[model samples]
Target: MKANRFVTVLIVLVFLVGGLFAQGQVERKAVEVKVLAGVTGGKDDTENALFEKEMEKATGLNITWEKPPSGYDQVLMQKLGAGEVYDLLYLNQFQMYALANQGALTDLTSRIAASSVYSENVDPDELAKIQMNGKYYAGFNKLEVFPLVNVNKAITDKVGINLNTLNTLEDYYQMLKKVKNYMENTVGRKPYYPFFTYMPDIWDLQPWFSSAGVRRGVFKDASGKKYAPFVQAQAKPVWEWLAKLYREGLMDPASFTGKTGDMRNKMWQSQEIVMDVDWAAWTGLYNNNAMTAGTYPHTVNVVGLPGTKSPSGTFMLEQGGASLWAIPANAKHPDEAFKIIEYMATKEGGLLLSAGIEGYDYVIQDGKLAFTEVGLAHAKDHGAPFPISTQFDLGVLGTMNPGVLESVAIGKRADVEVAPMGYADGELDARKYYDIMSKWMTDCIMGKMSADAAMRGAENELRINSLID
Candidate 1:
């Protein structure tokens, strides 16, 4: 009787174990998703991986990532035009407007409202950026505009100039002259250029112009007409000032066509440049390599750009949030995509995507977040996996770090202030501005044409494109 009773218990235990295994497998749903994203360095990679991992776990769905090799916007356009459907799409300001105008993207306002996770995580201001015609179409992970000027402390010290004392554009010019003189006399090398302003890209040029009390390119007038600030009378002084920098050899001539990678390498490896304006993401790359090679000088620091007041008696345009994430009209699993977006926006998700898995990747010590040396080394060398939302999407969930805010305060010139350029509307015609402005600005910066001529040409082009009445 005892032997028979023991046999019955063993059989029940075996069945129970099998049932649990089957249940686990059943809960996991197998699905495929294609995502379009712009390629950046570490943060983007880490964020993309984290989003995929978390969403897979929560929804029991397997996601396949299909990222394009070239320009994400162009690739997305081509794919959509070809009738290719993706599970999720990453949209920037231009692309979002273009796609929405073409009816190529889904209305996400309803989906966002329905998701408890999204409702809890998203901020109002952030939500405003993604809205078009009173409907929300995109979500963001962070909501701050971060532009940091990285300076080589060694170069400044070698010239005996105080970095802190340099505030105005004139002060900046004098310091650059000193550095250039030092390079010529002592090092027998080109003293690092004073400013490596990227003229080919309007996004880059906007901030510098913004510092000079001019909000040019994409802005509006009092009558609500779309106006290019660079062409206005107020912009004349600013352009003339930059033209002087070019003529005086304070700024690099090659920056007109230099790619971002070329500029990054020149600053990081060669240390040939004294200062370069870049986003905060570059900081991670700098910290990772600076200590290992001991190439970066200890005195180097990051700060904001100088700002000036406009003649109109207002400050330069105040910048706002960067990029955001949008789901494509053809996304296969919209529901699952929203879940992933929500997770990354939440505190729990932000930590995971930005920092990584807690015990394995980082540890908290003394109420301060500290990475183990090994963890830091790992992040520096191998790079961490982050969710896609955190990288492309801004203002969805995570709060800006104090450092970013401080940089903004520093960059704001006393006379220059930030102003809103108006939120993006779902209009395909808006994208025409990019093609027109980029061409005209490039011509103006290269000295191929006069600023006045370029402005007139741009106006004519806008008229031709129907952007102006």
Candidate 2:
């Protein structure tokens, strides 16, 4: 009878442990993570649904992707201002820093230090780039691409210009003149302007300024004194060059007032502008769009030039700031949300982000990724064109857009200096600096004020705003 009682008690203990295991599985699966995305998603509901499903399956957490149709920046600000809770939020580097300053973001320093996946997949330098006061608050979304000079080779070719031979600001100016003359006289497009720049924030000027070794934004010397390159004497020639373009009608007057969409249209669709400083991705995108319009290579072959040499005798390209993912301080599932962030820093996660959902986006034919018609149409990048994972194989994503490989290779050149926009060790408010510089610089470029006067005004305003010491 005692032996029988022992067997019954043993069965009861087994049942209790099994029940607890089942409950744990259910709880793990029940964890919900809501993400508010700003940079990516919005392809369509179908694609968004597929992406969420795949992410959920991979991370083993229920993920809700909240990607606004438009005005994402405004939406982001509104939601955060109103104290709306979200597990994860997508932000640019500036937003990350701004929020970090407000203590709105969770400090991920300890968590990231403890993560093996991050150590294996993410570059330490990249992590260093996003740290605030030596503490991590976010993880990188993608490797930033730089803006450079993109010229329509077809237009340049018509003018008998060899893009390879162009190496100075004067060379670019001459090339633009030739294109402008050809478009007006030969192509019969009256008053043809060959260049465009968004002057509101003084966007797309880094390539031109790099010619004079003027780096954009705030920086410090070895003695730790803050200074802005644009307000220095070295920047005068660069300003004068732009004024020359504006005065000579080589630059579009609408550049000061037009949106980036207008610039893109002039670059690819209208083919009115033969040259402009734009993102490296735009080099490929230009070719791809032209190809879609059936005017590629021969008529609209857009190619990237590493711009004129800096004083250091190297091509200087400024990287766009980082796109990142961060968890809010009020997140309910901080630990679970971090699991997603950690997973994203893995090879498997990189594959999903780059190649899209397996079987849906691609199929294994002969042990290789064979993209479907849908995948072929979309070009396979959900958010990260270059995944943050060091272990990721880019070849798995298949062919890139035309002109992309050539443009991307420019960053790897030994003669090139690919630098980020200077931030004075994260003490600078980029938005304020941009506004102050834009106000004064527009006057200079538009001939309303002398370059020296504009620089003086910008410098004073910058000092008042504490953007520079």
Candidate 3:
């Protein structure tokens, strides 16, 4: 009887231990990953909360997202400076390069190599573009796109100018002049500025530089020496051309001091400007906004221009910087955080990021995705308008706002060369380069200095600041 009691007691102990082991496994599986995201899933707290729930369900892990709507760059620096720990953080390509140089980010080189999700979804060439000094410190959030010329075709039609024929610098100049004349005289709209280019950082001047056979940003010669193309003699004519536009009242004075928000408002809402340079994705947005305002397709029809031809006969368009997600060096759950990043590069994750929550933003009907009323209103983009996954099919998302497809298609043209701005290799200080160049460019365009003087002043400042040479 004692033997029987001893055996029963041993069996009871075994069962109890097994139950506890299973409970421990469950607890370990429920790890909560904290993220300080700046690029995606931070627009609305309620929406982000739902997004978090969806991400949690997909990854089988708990997630905490802290996304501040404004001043994200400053906030990111402050958080890292304070030694705050987060499993994941969102950053642009430049920020990734800067942080990687500082050793503040985890070296993701091996992690990405081992991840089958990355291999299957992201292109190797794409990864190569974002590498910092031969090592990857972050994963891509979205495919980088280029900004192109967006013109109000309705106004162009009124001027009797065909957008397809606009290939040379003189062509655009005459077109802008005609647009100004027609809008002021026929439409009776006073102060009808025809062209708008944001002078802050001298944004969207790539096309004009291409016309002079000069690519903007820092470049290396065959001898491995660095040089900036814009401050050089070849870029003089483009600078002079811009100053001429400002002098002629064809360019808005606001371009010298106004923000991008102000530019957008002038383009779409008030229709004060007939032409401006903007992102390809914004082609659809401009039309979508006009559609909401009940003036689309006829009164506010917008079209994308592949920009003026270079001397080599190719249109050089500058691609925007990549948006990335990185793991901080001090992150507690890097493995789980990388899992989330990997998921974002997957087809399923791409759908979530682009199309938004399934039930709330869309519904699957008859084995196909159908956008709900909310989804239609949502405009089919939560964060990434264009997903980074190679395996992802955007056709499943259905049609986008009008003009978007055409605008995006410009980069795919046979004669177009889409490249990123200089300092893309991340060896130079891009911020300093932009500030000095913009200041001088603004001084020249606003008639404070001659174009030659501006270029000389810029070259001197860039050399002194160690941005060039």
Highest TM-score against the true fold, candidate? 3
Global CA lDDT computed for model 3:
0.87
Q: What is the C-alpha lDDT of each candidate?
A: 0.58, 0.86, 0.87
Pick the winner on TM-score between candidates 1 and 3.
3
lDDT of 3 by residue, 1-29 (tens): 99999999999999999999999977874
Give the distance in Å from residue 143's predicted Cα in candidate 1 to where it truly belongs.
4.1
TM-score of each: 0.70, 0.86, 0.87
Best-to-worst lDDT order: 3, 2, 1
Q: What lDDT tens digits, residue by residue, belong to model 2 across residues 142-188?
A: 77778888999988888999999988889988988988888999989
Scanning candidate 3 in windows of ten residues, the lowest lDDT window is: 38-47
Candidate 1 residue spans exceeding 4 A from truth = 1-53, 58-87, 110-123, 141-144, 160-167, 186-192, 220-224, 298-323, 328-336, 357-450, 467-469
Inter-residue clash pairs, candidate 3: none
- TM-score between candidate 2 and the true structure: 0.86
Prediction RMSDs, each to the true structure: 8.7, 7.4, 6.4
Off by over 4 Å in 2: 1-30, 220-225, 425-427
